[model samples]
Target: MNKKYLQNFYNQYKVFDFLHTIRQCGIISFWIFLSVLFTTSSSLLVQEYPGKVRQYTHTIEFDYVNWTFDAFWQKFLQSSIRLEDYLPEKQPSGIVREYLRSVRQISQLESQINVIYADPKITDKVAAAKSYQLQLDQFNAYKKQLAPYAESTLQSQISTILSENGLTLIGQPIPPVLYHSTPLPMALIVSPRNKIQQDANISLLADMTAGDMAALEDEVMKNLNVSALVVPIGGVGIYPTMVMSTSDLSFLAETVAHEWTHNFLTLRPLGINYETNSDLRTINETTASIVGTEIGKQVLKRYYPDLLPPESEISTQDTTSDTSNPQATEPEPFNFRREMHTTRVQVDKLLAENKIDAAETYMEQRRQFFWDNGYMIRRLNQAYFAFYGAYADTPGGAAGTDPVGPMVRALRKQSSSLAAFLNQISMVTSFDQLTRMVDNPPAG
Candidate 1:
């Protein structure tokens, strides 16, 4: 929060933001006009080092507020629902439905095009550009054919599940899916450098280049002294609640339900006081993870039964056994959950012991250990754990010794059904509420 450092950080972040805005919105002329306006209005007189005041004619606040994604959503909402072209007999047959088939084709094509566009090997720039446009056009045409049907079917399933579970907050219909993928891998900035502190939240995310993320993270960390993590987010649910068009059908359905859960919690105390209380933030994320997974499975079962694992096998694969030993599994193939859990707990222990440098070294050592075991993690720092350690809905590995995830899971176990679990968790606003609600809990 240092003013001088923030000023330096803002300059770097703003340029990336503007570039991302152009990429996502495709409003080149509009951005060009705005850029020219900002340039003309602002002038750089002198560059000063730390403790010196460097002034600008016009100061622009660098925040995620710039990324409305409004134009994209508005276009999607208007066009995605008017699917009067395809007849019922023309659609595909069986559990692998038409919408799923069409969406998979679109998603794969979109991903391929994105990869092509990012590739630097093409010597014929003009030819490559033309090909990109053609592919994009084809992708859009395909999307237009089935996006509405897909979105409507998915939303209907989500709504039915929510209603059945007594989650009536989503009774009113909302335009919840985007017809096309925006871009890949958005960067988010969380502040204060302390993993446990959650107040005064701020994040900047854009579907920009992966290379840009390293530079951006360094700027945020060295200059602004904040925690930054760039995630390949499947879906984002800020307001309108959107699923990335290119996501696999199963993942797409799950993400849609996941994001909607975020939207649903936004009206409650857990969401309202999200930043003010770190534990509440954990509770909120854990709740979403739990509900989203359950709802996603239900959607798969209803629409794409083939995607759903057999109920008999679910206990073996997905569900953690109530009385299962932690040491029961073979030590091969790198258990990420157990390893990540160890990292979180140890990192906290070191940080608590006033060993800052030791904590960092510990993380790097752990990162190398993971790499040695065939898990290539790019970075392992406080910032990384600070962002990812929130979701504690499911137990083991990531949950580590974090009381929130376990407490939430325990509450779910005590409940009669998924709906009852969600209903009880929704009523919880703080860690204290979780403690009071659960029985035979871990002693503080």
Candidate 2:
């Protein structure tokens, strides 16, 4: 009897361990999925999907950013980390400085292309997208050229970023499926791993509504980041409508940079806990946006100034930059970065009042206010921001800037060495630790 009892206990222990592991691997609902669900735009189901691209006569031009993709990326990431070098008169270690500088170049290029394509320029390519077939052959050719580079350079860095997390295969080495028409918002994997199908479009996911958000929260993203809803919708949406995955060199130049920032802080335990909180979420995105944009800008300046030109004039398409605004309808005019900053301010005031339900109500009210302001904002909720935090910001109690997103503003005030800051940050295990390192470091 004693032997039998011992065996049964062992079996139960095994089952408990097995259950715990599985439970740890899955997702929870993001509160944002509860925000809004509209009647499926019959438009989504229309027999012929109205293609989003436009038509033009001039053959669409594929302007090279000039620098060999590798050189461009290296300089970009270097600039991102140099701030730390400037900070405290110290700098990022060579390895991390190289990694982040390259990442900055990659992310900003992605943002730039997204903005460029969205603008009224490139009529030929736009037309091709709208059923006109233009010569994307050059674009395809460049993509092929950068294929190995992205797989090796950008993807590898991404792995380093996600080393601690089990989700290491976010980017694969497989060849991309090339489409004749420009797939809007390139690079999206609906089902994890190789689903035997491919879509490069990964820009604006705005059409999603409350119910769809719920389904996705219940069925998809929540399993990864329960606060996925609060996560800001990434990718460019405007005259230069674009997404994370644009081109190959650009892929290395951008997508890897921005997305990897998400992978970095996401490995932390506490950041995961607040993944469902809006204030926490904004802090994450704002941080990443600021960092990523700065890196991108500097990289462009150094390596591909021609492709992005030093020109300052806005394209006709960029009427405004004002979304992510707890107050606006679009992501620009004020742009996502500034909007995030302001939202940080607003969410703080609302939270201090401590009328919790009222605060929640404000989410929907603000979203509705978006519609009232003439822009289409699907839903608003704590979940929306929660999932958004993965990008760059973190939960700072009262909700300041996150430590991750690729925002430029943060770098503006960074201490001596980008390399030193990165070295200290690389080993951190939680968002709080990362922020503390950034905000107040113990003497070396």
RMSD of each: 13.4, 20.3
> Per-residue error at 44 for model 1, in Å?
30
C-alpha local distance difference test of each model: 0.57, 0.35
lDDT (10s digit) by residue, model 2, range 131-207: 21122344345454333333333334333333322223444311111011122321122211111111111222434
Winning model by lDDT: 1
Error of 1 at 179 (Å): 9.6
Model 1 misses residue 105 by how many Å?
A: 4.1
TM-score of each: 0.70, 0.38
**Runs off by more than 4 Å, candidate 2:** 1-211, 214-243, 247-252, 260-291, 309-357, 372-375, 389-414, 430-444
Q: What clash pairs does model 1 have?
A: 337-397, 392-405
Q: Roughly what TM-score does model 1 have, to 2 decimal places?
A: 0.70
Task: Please give the range of 10 consecutive residues that has the lowest summed lDDT in model 2.
Answer: 30-39
Model 1 lDDT per residue over 196-250, tens place: 4432222234444567667655655666665554555565555345455553666
Q: Judged by lDDT against the true structure, how good is candidate 2? A: 0.35
